[model samples]
Target: MAKKKNKKASPNTIGTNKQARRLYEILETFEAGISLLGTEVKSLRGGHVSFKDGYVSFHDGSAFLVGVHIAPYEQTGQYDQHDPERRRRLLLHKHEIDVLQSKVDQRGLTVVPMKMYFSRGKVKVQIGLGRGKNVHSKKQDLKDRDIQRDTQRQLASYK
Candidate 1:
């Protein structure tokens, strides 16, 4: 009889853009593959990524991820490492890109990167179509979140 190989448990999520959620009202989300170099992939696996100010831009009928930072892999030589803040190409179908571009152009909405995760051994990005929220709405969202947290705490205590 052959022995079974043990599989290690690991989380699929690499990082999330919490600021994007707090600043924008997300309307729709689409999953797309990100083009990354080897060192970038290693850094992502170690959770060394920042999504601050990350957004998607359409150019010549293709979408690109911008403003995101993937830290350089420390174990690799300097020359072998990838840029920490380079624009990455996103793999989306032509029709999907067209739809997002149309929404951005016609509705004045923004395309932001919501999260990045590994799916079936491939890295995937979750992009959201969002409208920028005003200061008052952001404050309201904070208040509502606090209220919901308090209610959940009270319910848990009662139980």
Candidate 2:
């Protein structure tokens, strides 16, 4: 008989956004394994995930990722469908939780999801603790971004 072929796997870098990076400054980043169902994993692998409206929350000393939607895999069985928008648990260390708790206790900070990537064949979410940006600050940020992009474009032309 021919030898069995083990299924191959690859880690994909699902690029994040400016908000994730901007907040990553004061934001302590902690990687945690996310709980996922079979279809959820398949959908995430198929790039059917979104973190735009997602936010992290702490409950009973455990942090969770909420509002992240991973579409159901179409090839799966029909009866036991997993909820796409259910609250998913984030696996973090005790010390990390303690530190996050203190920072979250402060009025201005909130936890945000940074990136989600596969690690050792399991999906992981990178969460961050950060303070919100005011309207003026957001405007200043846009200005800075435009300036940076212009500088990069100018440099590219000279090359």
Candidate 3:
């Protein structure tokens, strides 16, 4: 008789953050593990989280994720529900944390959330160190995008 084949369940892989469709520039992206409670983890698995208010800060040789909201589990009650807007710690190497800290201190770079996803059953947040876009720069980006879209549409029509 042949042995039965056992199949392992697939690990969850999905983005849980607002994607910037027209990101003018992406400087650097860092993979950092996120600290989450049981309920928070469950909420992320549902995949409706937002990064509109998410930002990262370094303190005491570590980076912390601030303003990242993970809503409470819908089926849970208030007794054991953790704060949805709690500050979560980001797990990164000591050297990497130091580098990010130095950049923020020396330069005027800002830490912004690029995306959030699950890897090997652990939730991870990708942070981007970026310089803010000025008004004219943003307008130029919009115009460039519009031109690209128009070009693509014309090419499609000709084909």
Best lDDT among the predictions, by candidate number: 1
Provide TM-scores for the models: 0.89, 0.81, 0.85
- Counted clashes in each candidate structure: 0, 0, 0
Ranking 2 against 3 by TM-score, winner: 3
List, residue by residue over 7-34, the lDDT tens digit for candidate 3.
3233454454433423425578889998
**Candidate 3 root-mean-square deviation in Å:** 6.8
lDDT of 1 by residue, 9-35 (tens): 348888888898889999999999999
> What's the CA error at residue 126 for candidate 1, in Å?
0.6
- Candidate numbers, best lDDT first, in rank order: 1, 3, 2
Q: Which runs of model 3 end up more than 4 angstroms from their true locations?
A: 1-24
lDDT of 2 by residue, 31-131 (tens): 88887888888887777877877888888889788988788889888886789899998888889887887888865578888777887788888787777
- Indicate the worst ten consecutive residues by lDDT in candidate 3: 6-15
Q: Give candidate 1's TM-score.
A: 0.89
Model 1 global lDDT (CA atoms, 0 to 1)? 0.93
